[model samples]
Target: MHVVITGANRGIGRALAQGYAQAGEDVTGTARSGDDGPRLDVTDPESCAAFARGLGDRAVDLLVCNAGVYPDKGQNLDTGYPPEMWAEAFATNVTGVFLTVQALLPHLARATAPKIAIISSQMASDSRAPGGSYIYRASKAAALNLGRNLAVDLGPRGIAVGIYHPGWVRTDMGGDAADIGAAEAAKGLMSEFTALSLASTGAFRTWDGQDHPF
Candidate 1:
């Protein structure tokens, strides 16, 4: 399958790309800075359009909207998360996902059964709102909502959209003391991605395939 993964320069994105490639699947891993090439600034509409243009008519069987930002990671409700932080977080974590999917609709249509995996976070769940990291939480919640709606719209076209929390992975964002390594998270997520289908579309799931409470 031809899989397109965004923010693949590092962390879970890079691991997923490497794993998929080793398994003999066609993978296109992209980064924002175009580091070592294939630049895709998901925050910019024209950039997404340009990326799609570069792809031409190539089929994208699985589009992993993995690019995101936790701009207010260390900020607080009081004088920490500024308006710009909220804007940056939402732009990359929420709007960027929409733009990438919008730009890739044509390529996805070419596939027999296309799928979109949105990498959300467990913190997005309303049931587990302990507060703190408000910006990241809100943005992820928006992304979760976006994925659900996309699933509804795309299911008719044989496209499945699954929102996922990749676990507390050890990455630059996840921190060095996180639960698991990026490779481990990638493995579980790959398994989850493989099992996703029209029947399970619009589901909020964990990296290990457990249904996540919305």
Candidate 2:
């Protein structure tokens, strides 16, 4: 399968890209550095659009929206999250995905069964989190909604949109004490993606295939 993965420099995105590439699948992995290719600053619509075009006429079987940032510099709910932080988070985690999907729709349409997967967080779910994550949580929650809405709107186009939580993965973002390793998380995520069908569109799921609440 031909796949496009964002944030490939490190963490879960890097692991997933390596996993697919190791499996002999054609893959395009984007990162901030030119180590793989040019930087994909997700906050820039032009960058996202250009990246989609870079895929050429190849029908992308999967597009993994994995680029994000969690600026947990000195955060606390008691201090209140700033609107600028929220905006920054949304620019990368939500609007970036929207633009990426929009630009790739044409290429994706040519595929037999195109899939769009957004890397979401369990903290995004209102039912899952009692508090914290402030800006990051809000942004991911918006991402979930976008994925679900796309699932409905793009259903007729034969594209499957899935929201995936990779679990508490041990990455730079996840910290050292995270429960799951990047390789294990990547394996589980691939398993879930492989098992996905048109019937499962609009579903929020974990890397292990467990259904999550909206």
Off by over 4 Å in 1: none
Q: Which ten residues in a row have the lowest lDDT in candidate 1?
A: 70-79
Model 1 lDDT per residue over 174-203, tens place: 999999999999999999999999999999
> Which prediction has the highest TM-score against the true structure?
1
Q: After superposition, how far is residue 200 of candidate 2 from its true place, in Å?
A: 0.3
What's the distance in Å from true for residue 151, model 2? 0.2
What are the lDDT scores of the predictions, listed in order?
0.95, 0.87
The number of clashing residue pairs in model 1 is: 0
Q: Model 2: C-alpha RMSD to truth?
A: 1.4
